[model samples]
Target: MYTTLLHQYQLTLSSRNALFDYCETVKPEDLLKPLATINNESMASLLLHVANCYVFWLANSVMQEKHAYFKGDEHLDLTAVRNVYGQVDLLMNEFLNHFKDSLDVPLLITRPDGSQLTRSPFEIFTHAITHEFHHKGQVVNMSRQLGYTPVDTDVVRE
Candidate 1:
C-alpha cells in the first residue's frame, strides 16, 4: 500500500516538474502579475500557496513540525520557488516514512483555532496532493491568460 502511494506521489512530482519547467519560460514580470480571475494571485503566488498547503497540512499539522510558511512575494523567482519545494520534498519524505506503517491509523490534530480533528495519514496525504493538482489547473489557466499555451502535465500520457 505504501509502495502504491509512493508511486502515485512520484507521478505527481513529474507533473509538477513539467509545470515548473513551463514556468521558467514565462516572463519574469508576468509570472508575478496578478490575474483577476485567479483571485488576483500571481503564478508565483499560486506556486507558493501550493507548497504552503503541504507544509501546513503534512509537515506542520500532521507531523507536528513547526515549519515557517513560504511567502509568495518573497519568492519572486523560480529558483527561490524551487528552493522552497526542496524543503517541501524533505518534509514529504519524512511524512511518508513516519506514517508508512500507520497510513490508516487515526491521528488527532489540533487546529489553530483550538478545535480538534482526527485524520488518518492516508487522508491527509490524499488531501494535500489533490489540493495541489486542483491549484495546478488554476496555474495553467493563469498561464493561458498570460498568452502562453499550456503544456501536457498529466500523470498519464496519450
Candidate 2:
C-alpha cells in the first residue's frame, strides 16, 4: 500500500508540474491579478492555498510539526512557486516515510475552531490530494477566464 500510494503521489507531481509549466508562461503580474469571479483570489493565491492545505494537514495536523504556511505575496513567481512545492515534496516524503508502517492508524487532530476529529494517515493523504485536484480545476478555469488556454493537468493525460 505504501508503494502504491508513493507511485500515485509521483503521478500527482507530474500533473502538478504541467500546471507549473503553464504558469511559467504567464506574466508575474497576471499570476497576481485578482479575479472577482474566483472570490478575488489570484492564481498565485490559489496555488499557495493548495500548498498550505498540504502543510496544514500533513505537517501540522498529522505529523505534529509546526511548519509555517507559504504566503501568496512571497511566492508570486514561478521560481518561488516551484520552491514552495519543493517544500511540499519534502513534507510528503517525510509523511509517507513516517507512516509507512501505520498508515491506517487513527490519530486525533484538532481543528482551528477548537474542535477535534480522529483520522488515519491514509484518510488525510486522500483528503489532501483530492482537495488539491479540486482547486487545480479551479486554477485551470481561472486561467481560461484570464484569457490563457488551459493545458492537460491530469494524472493520466492523453
Q: Which candidate ranks first by lDDT, i.e. highest? A: 2
Task: For residues 4-112, write the lDDT of model 2, one tens digit per residue.
Answer: 9999899989999999998887778888888999999988899999999999999999898999999777887879988999999999999999999999999999987
Query: What's the CA error at residue 20 for candidate 2, in Å?
Result: 0.5
Please provide, for model 1 over 1-158, each residue's C-alpha lDDT reduced to its tens digit, 9 standing for 90 to 100: 78988998999999999989888899999989999999999989988999999999998899898999998768989999989988888898889999999999999998888899999999999999999999999989999999999888788854
Please give the lDDT score at residue 78 for candidate 1: 91
Clashing pairs in 2: none
The global Cα lDDT (0 to 1) of model 2 is 0.92
